[model samples]
Every structure is written in C-alpha cells, then in structure tokens.
Target: MAGQSLGTILGRAFRLRCPKCGGGRMFSGLLRMHDRCSECGLVYERDPGYFLGSSYVNYGFTALTLTPAYVTLHYAFGWTNTQLAFPLVGWVLVFPVFFFRYARALWLGMDVYFDPQSFEDPAESEQPEPPVR
Candidate 1:
C-alpha cells in the first residue's frame, strides 16, 4: 500500500503516534485522547466507532509484555502463582489502563496509517463552526 498499513502502524504504536498521521500523539492522558491532536488537529473524538480492530493489538500487547514475566517466574525460579503473586499482581494491575491507552493508540494508528482521511481530508471534512456561524 502507498500508505503505511497495519504492521507499520503497530510499529508506530510502540513509538506512540497517531498511526494514521504518524505526526501526532495517540494519547492526551492515561485514559483520554485529546479531542484532537495538538500537532495535527486530527480529531481523535471523530467517530472512531469501529475501534475494535485495536482490541486484539492491545490484548496482544498485554500477552507479550506479561506472559514472559510469568514464564520467567515459572522457569527461572520455579515460582508458582502463590510465589509469583506480588510480581504477577503488580504486572497485571496496570492491565486496564495500559490496554486502554494501547487500544486507542493502536486504533488511531490503524485508521490514520491505512486511511489518511482518518487523520483528515480537507475537502470532505468540515471545520466546526463558531456558535454565531
């Protein structure tokens, strides 16, 4: 594809860009996307209703980052869930927040990367008007 496409989007996810634009952030905070990006004016809140594509990306991220920790506990030191409780819990504790950010970022990346219009297209998109207009 002339556009960056999915795999590249995931790589950009690691870098934390708007996967589509690759020029703005994928997050504005722990659980929020700024209504738009400060740099690109990409409207994150713009009806990303089909963000489910990134659900697996976020889940895979969880599996990749956490599974190894569990494996290390089991193989390196023969730790059971009881023994690995603290470390496992500590790792698992961040799951929701991490996944939220991960999902949003990954989704944005996919949209923007494959469809630049996911970032914005001048002619087809409209600017929000002032209350008077």
Candidate 2:
C-alpha cells in the first residue's frame, strides 16, 4: 500500500482503526485491544514498551487542555480554585480513560506515517521457506 497522508492518518486515529490497513479495529471493547490488525496482521505493540509512549500523548493533551480551561474559568468567569478543584480532578481522572484508545491510535498513526515501509507484510519482505526433506 502507498504511504498515507497526514489527514488520512489522523482520520484513522480518530476512528480508532489500524494505521496500516485503516479497516481493522484498534480496540475490541472499551479497553481491550486486539494484538494485531485483523485485516493486515500488523502488530499493534511492536515491542514490550511500545505503547508506553502513548502516555505522553495522553498527558500532553490533558495538560494542554486543562491549563487553558483552568485559566479561563478562574480569570474570565471568576471561579475559585476550590470551586474548580472537584471538576478538574474529575477531568484528570476521567478524560485519560476516555481518550486512551485515541491516544494509542494516534501513536500508531504517527509511527506508520513516519515509517510506512516498516509496516509492510513480513511475508513479502522475507525469502521463501526452505524445502523439507
């Protein structure tokens, strides 16, 4: 398959589809992900710590949004820090869970976009098996 555009990659990330095929689902349930893409057989976690980088995506998003929200609510709306505490804490706790799938998807999408050739079928890249006796 040809290399995908940025829009295509982001679209697949948002839809939680496999970055390689864009057809196989990234998650089977709310928090359950398939080991690999069913359509393309592309492994979701390339290494033991592959998805660990996804935490940066999640944390980056939360911090970027939370800071702005806190500033706006505290200054523009004259909300007290105590008043904002409960909701912001809830957001911190909840949003990551909700965004988990998208974060992983985005991580995978970025990897595929930057290294498209790495995702090609292993069988195609490897030589034929040796004949049996």
Candidate 3:
C-alpha cells in the first residue's frame, strides 16, 4: 500500500477495483456496490450516506469538464444557447449516471489514500458509535 502511487490508486479507481487491494471489483451491478471487497475484505461503505461524497465528485467532474466545453462552444464557435441547452442538459443528467460507479470508486480511493486506517481489517478496527442525543 505504501509503495502504491497516486497514479496507481487513480488507475485502480478508473478500473473500478477495490481501492485497497486493487483486485476485487467495486460494483455488483450498474449502481449497486458490493458490501465488501472480495480480495481484501474492505468495506465499501463506512457509514450510512457515505456515498454522498461520491455525488459531489460526480457533480464536480460534470461541472468542471462540461462547463468549459459549453462556454467554448457557445462563445468561440458561436453556437446559440438554445442549441447548446438540450445537449448540455442531457449531458449533465446522463453523464452523472454513467459516472456514478467511477465517482464512488474515486471517492473511496481518495478516502483510502488520506485515511490509511480505513484499510485496516474491520474485525480489528472498532467502529465509532453515533452520539446519543
């Protein structure tokens, strides 16, 4: 794990593999994720709503990549906003769906990189309980 580089982790993310082992698959279906990694037994979801982070990833990716293209086409190419609107809207809606798995994978990879302890065995690590209010 220490020997792995950022590129390696990102590559694994692009491949949709388990961020830790880079062997087990990250998803079971289009939007369904395997509960844990098959190779390393890493849990995909640390808590309920964990995937909310991935939604932000998906949104940021879509906005960052598409916004520039839209601006370029509209201003430089002289395409009308009406012409760009449909395709841009469709892209914003559709691309996120396609990118869902990758976003989650990337999010997981980022988390694993920043929080190395997340890669620890679940049995060995103690899960923090929610505060009782």
Candidate 4:
C-alpha cells in the first residue's frame, strides 16, 4: 500500500484506528489494545519499551495545554495556588488516563510515518536468503 499523508495518519490516530490500515480498531477496550491490526495485521508493539514513549507525549501534551489555562486563570482571574491545587491535580491525574490511548496511538503513528519499514509485513521482511553454495 502507498504511504498515507500526515493528516490522514493523524486523523487515524485521533480516531484510535490502526495507523497502517486506518480501518481496524486500535483498542479492544478502554485500556486493552489488540496485538495487531485486524485488517492489515500490522503489529502494534514494535518493542518491549515502545509504549513508554507515549508517556512523554501524555506529559508534554498535558503541560502544553494546562500551562496556558493555569497561567490565564492565575493572572487574569486572580485565582490562588491553593484554590487551583485540587482542580489542577485532578486534571493532571485524569487527562493522562483519558489521553492514554490516543497518546500511544499518535506515538505509533508518528513512528510509522517516519520509519515506514517498521510497518511492513513481518513475513515479507523475514524471508530467508538463498544459500551461497
């Protein structure tokens, strides 16, 4: 299959579809993801520590989004740090959980976009070479 555009990949990621096929469902449940894409059979986990990168995405996204809101509320509305503590803590805790799937999906999609070979069929890539004899 030809490569998809960045927009298409991001769209698939946001929708939680397989980044390769964009048709198969990415997750079987809220936190449980399938081993591979149902439609294209592309493996989701590239390595044991693959999904750890998604935690960075989650943290960066939370910080980038919430920092603006926090600064605005603190300066413009004169909200005290104590007053915002509970809500900020709750948002920090909850947003990561809510965004977990998407963060992982987006991370995978971005990786696939940059490293196209990673998404190729394993069977195709694993063919044995002919003997030199």
Name the candidate, 3 or 4, with the larger lDDT value.
4
Among these predictions, the greatest lDDT belongs to 2
Local distance difference test values of all predictions, in order: 0.69, 0.92, 0.89, 0.91
Which is superior by TM-score, 1 or 3?
3
Model 3 agreement with the true structure over 27-127: per-residue lDDT tens digits: 98998889999998788898999989999999999999798989899999999999999999999999999999999999999988888774776665777
Number of the top-ranking candidate, with TM-score as the measure? 2
Clashing pairs in 3: none
Per residue, candidate 4 scores C-alpha lDDT tens digits across 10-95 of 99999999999899998999999999899988889978988999999999999987899799989999999999999999999999
Q: What does the lDDT read for residue 98 in candidate 3?
A: 96
Better of 1 and 2 by lDDT: 2
Least well predicted 10-residue stretch by lDDT in candidate 3: 117-126
**CA shift at 107, candidate 4, in angstroms?**
0.8
Task: Give the CA lDDT, 0 to 100, for residue 66 in model 1.
Answer: 85
Question: 1-133, model 1: which lDDT tens digit per residue?
Answer: 2467577788877776766556777666666566766675666656556666667777777778888988987999788888888877777677856677767777667666667654556655776877985
Q: Give the TM-score of candidate 3.
A: 0.86
What's model 3's overall lDDT?
0.89
CA lDDT of 92 in candidate 4? Answer: 95
Q: After superposition, how far is residue 97 of candidate 4 from its true place, in Å?
A: 0.5
